[model samples]
Target chain A: MRLPYLLAGLSVAAVYLVLLHVGEGRQREAEEHAKQGHVTASYAQLGKAYALYHEGHWPLLDTRNRHFAYDLGIVPKGYAIKQEMEKDHAPQAVLFGKLGRHAALSLVPLVDFRNYFYLGFAVTTEEEGLALAKALRSGAALDRDIKVAQGTGTLGSSTLYRLHDDIVETLVMDGVLARQDLTLPGRIPVIVERPRDGYAWVVFLDMHVEHLRYPGPFPLTSKFVDTLESDAL
Target chain B: MLHERYDWLDQARGFVVLLLIVSMPTSEYAGDLLTGDPVLGPPMLNHGYEYFDGDPAITTFIDSGQALFLLVMGFVGYTAFTSRLRKRGKGAAFWYCARRVGVLYALASIDCVLLELATSGKPKWGDFFYNGTFAMIALGTLCAFLSIVVIPNADRRMLFSVGLIMLHSLLYAFPFFDHHTWYDNILALPKFPFGTLGMCAMAIAGSSFGQWHAMDPDNPRTGFRKRIVPVSTAAFVAAYCMDWVQPAQHHDSNAAMLLQAMYIGGFMLMIFFAFGEVGFRFPLLSSLGRNLLLMFALGGLFIGIYLDCFPKEFLLQSPYLALLLGGLAPIVILSCVAVFLDRRGIMVRA
Candidate 1:
């Protein structure tokens, strides 16, 4: 009996080690494929790496970003969002919203990990952005602690507002029919109005308030918003 | 009467069932109570802190409970299969097991459909095979049965399960499968809860222990103490070291899978000795355990009824009251139903 049990344990241990080696080899192969500019092949290898390691970071994001029309830095490597995409002219996915639909274009980590943060933005024309911002500031059932910061400051050159904790207010999404009934909890709203080459642009940033304080400052500023406005193709 | 000798198994099952129902049903309501700042308490839906979104505590609880449930299934199922094979014939046993898989899938479908009807007022037929607990259990049961048939020897089967988990890990490392979509469900064949391989491995591994227990039915306590306890402990320690090195979240990682299965194996042993051997009967738990499937359905029904009837506003007004009522209502009701059924010696299997 003891002999059988011992043998079984030993065999399991051996197999586990061998599988780990195989997983590591796959990871190395994925890197080699990536370096050789085998984009599709690299993606396939990285997909295998992801399946093997589960939580291990692989560079599948380059292809994912290209597929989703996301900026390279928008979603960090080693993190992924749910792959469900909204059927719209522009690429959009909900980050922590119910049933894969939300009013904001947010970059929130799908899975929780170290250095978790959220960045949501809705781009519009200057006239539309201003009118929308005005309506949001004067929205019905506003919380008392909510204060919308006017103009640029240490916070940034954009208009920023922090809603009180646990507060839920419905916001109207102009031109977007699907998100008309968008309600967010403890939303931190910001607007960056910038005049670019041909059109004036307004970028609305709707962030989760609690996340803003704990994870520290995001590597974002009015300059970045201006870059978005300038770089829009 | 046939199951009376291993009442500990029932008790362990009951305990896990209680844990699963309490944690799962009240998650949304508990979120409202704990995070009491949301306006429009009742009828308004406030998203709760979802599992696997970085909450270590909830993730550990869910993972362990889920693995343990399947482990119990494997243990109990092996005994049922072998006994039928001996008494009736191989064909009868196979069909018996096949019917069980079908019944469990049917239960899972009904549960999903009803819950969807209650919550969203629209039911998708695809939800019948969603990656819910029962669907996974059904698939795991199928795999375990097949493994048992293929690898007749107990030790080889145990080794086979370990290989199966590694295979699952290897498959999962690939990114073809999408979780939470219809494709993620076990019915999609080669996705999580089925294709993921861990759950099936758990069931097969559990059956090996069942083999051991059946070998010496008269002296099960001694056999369990001498063999199962130490082996599970060593596996637990080994799995822990693997997890320490890898630190993967939830049950996705190989380390987490092994750790959870062994951890629950040890927990079942503890429950067996503490409650089963000592003649210290916990009626509520054992009652829920005896008719696990029925209780599971009843628990889901009661929870659906509670959520549908009393929305967050009514519940969240008094958070403590809501927590107590929301968490305990299904548990208490199911225990009563289980006990009532058990008292009449009604054991509803499938």
Candidate 2:
């Protein structure tokens, strides 16, 4: 009677030990897979934007001294408004805004841990935007060490690419275009405004990407475009 | 006609009743757990799964005191099956047992009414009081019927039964004075112990009748074996059927009412079979059964501590697993101790 009881006890203990070990192994594997996927996707998008800037046609801006001004539309004075855009234009602005927001939002969360930055600019001609878009698609114009990927979306027929952090910063500081808000870190201001009925010229401190629509004039300095090409080599 | 020999039918009936009483607590606990509510009072901890979260009124009124009664009656039945005496009258011991249980029922019912009044017409009154009263009455009724049928030599047993009642009443009045104060938090604990003592006395009285049945020449094994199968089967079937009825609508639903009836019936049957089969040999469990007052007080205290302090996640997450281990752990430990004690022939007697 005693021997049978002792045997039963030992068998139960062995079964318990085996179950604990198997459960722990499965938990570790799940954690590792989730972390690796997040990092890889972020790095790929940055590389594409850098390539487009190197080869695209840059827009020239109409300026007063160093500052370029672009008019969006007229607003009625003394009216308290919840949204900046008017009703007819609100839908178009929202669609375009989301594209730009997505690019900015994605890079924002990763900014502290990795090297990433946001670049905003506008161009005058569809041809110039297409030229910039094609250049972004080409790998040769981007830095040898960095990889490039680009995305295009319509916001009332304008396009933008989220650029790689290092490339965007290098072009802005090298004096390719006259700079505003230079005191702030990681702030590269490019004002895109509509002049008359024709189109808007967007100015960039660096070369533009063809995949993005150049709806108007862009204020880009020749020197910044030169540095981008030079950096690619 | 007075029989010089014991009649197995009487012994078997007492055994069935005892088993019914012993197993009542498990069913009550299971029912509360299934409904996701406490069957007793407020749980010791926040978000505790030990007690059902639903209205305690029904549980208190119907389940708790009833379970206690079943537990007590089960012990008494066991004691009656074990005693050695001649079966002078077939129905006398059974009537004696019934009367003794009736006393307990009356006391418990009054306790229930007092509790209900104290709580002031709350729905919880039903759970707290009525259920308890029902349990007492049901067990008392069953014992009354069984004692009248089986045990004739119950006069001496009646004295012990009265003693058991007094002891229980005393415990209820002064719980702190009990030897195991740590476990006697509930007012019911003292009553339960006394009930167990009464059962032992009843069993001792019933045993004398059992001896006569064993000696009867017309049918020796007929009384014990014949009764065991049907009674056990009836208990199993009744308990199974009762499992389907929802307790919440026990008052409204005829099915629920029927289920409770069956449960009581089934319990009594199981007790009868268990004692007849054991033949007073399992003195340890019998002793435990006999000392209902002490065992219940201590058991309740231990159960309270387990529910209050033991981790709920470990016990309730998988109830089947928890129950399997919970039931087995104690038995194994006891068996080991029993083995050690048995080697020295130092049996623990009630």
Q: Write the per-residue lDDT of candidate 2 for residues A40-61, one digit (tens) a residue.
A: 2232223233335645322221
Q: Whole-model Cα lDDT per candidate?
A: 0.53, 0.34
Q: Which residue pairs come into collision in candidate 1?
A: A50-B173, A51-B172, A51-B173, A51-B174, A52-B173, B41-B312, B41-B313, B42-B312, B42-B313
Number of the top TM-score candidate: 1
Evaluated against the true chain A, what TM-score does chain A of model 1 have?
Answer: 0.17
lDDT of 1 at A8: 89
For B146-262, candidate 1 gives per-residue lDDT tens digits of: 888898888789778766765655554443342332111222224454333567788888888777676677877665776567668866776776554433344453545555566
Residue-by-residue lDDT tens digits, candidate 1, A187-224: 23322222223222111222211111211122233343
Q: Per-candidate TM vs. native?
A: 0.58, 0.27
lDDT of 1: 0.53
CAPRI-style docking class of model 1 based on DockQ: incorrect
Model 2 CAPRI rating: incorrect
Question: For model 2, what TM-score does chain A reach?
Answer: 0.24
**Alpha-carbon shift of residue B199 in model 2 (angstroms):** 17
Candidate with best lDDT:
1
